[model samples]
Target: MTDQKKAKKKALKDSQLIVRIAGSERDRFVSLCDTLDTSAAREIRRFIRGFLKEHDDQLDGQ
Candidate 1:
């Protein structure tokens, strides 16, 4: 397999996550994301990946 194909497979988003936040906060966040030409889901995924990288050691037990 080529490197590009391997990367495509690795990048698959095959999961669901549910989060609850105050309705007003969620509305504002979504509006900001739209203004930045991105979706809330995309930002959340980026945040999750960054957070995981930052605290990976703390998650080793899980």
Candidate 2:
């Protein structure tokens, strides 16, 4: 890959989001993800990308 591509990929992976939720809810989510053979982070990222695509037009005026 080119340097620019590598940099972009690195930038995409560099950020962290910290969310505070009920401990029980978090445990349940983690268990479900484990059963599904995926990590919680992957599911959260998928949800975030889908959400952005769905609502991207709302940002046109902002």
Candidate 3:
């Protein structure tokens, strides 16, 4: 494909992070997980997406 397509592919692959939350935090995470009805990975991804949408520009200048 094109350079832009290749960049997009790389970006998608690079856009994931692995996190370890403590047990107390995990209890909260699992509560949100159940509310979202998704695996922990997905719930975290959804939260990050919404967070970034709301604060990306503000965050970038920090």
Q: Taking the tens digit of each residue's C-alpha lDDT, what string does model 3 give over 2-62?
A: 9999999788767657677798999987888789778877766778889999988998878
Q: TM-scores of all models?
A: 0.74, 0.81, 0.48
Better of 2 and 3 by lDDT: 2
Whole-model lDDT, model 1: 0.94
Sorted by TM-score, highest first, which candidate order results? 2, 1, 3
Instruction: Name the 10 consecutive residues with the lowest summed lDDT in model 1.
Output: 6-15
Angstrom error at residue 44, model 2: 0.4
lDDT of 2 by residue, 1-62 (tens): 99999999999999899999999999999999999999999999999999989999998898
CA lDDT of every candidate: 0.94, 0.98, 0.82
**The candidate that achieves the highest lDDT relative to the unseen native structure:** 2
Q: In model 2, how large is the Cα lDDT of residue 52?
A: 89
Evaluated with TM-score, which candidate comes out highest?
A: 2
- Show model 2 residue runs off by greater than 4 Å: 1-8
lDDT against true structure, model 3:
0.82
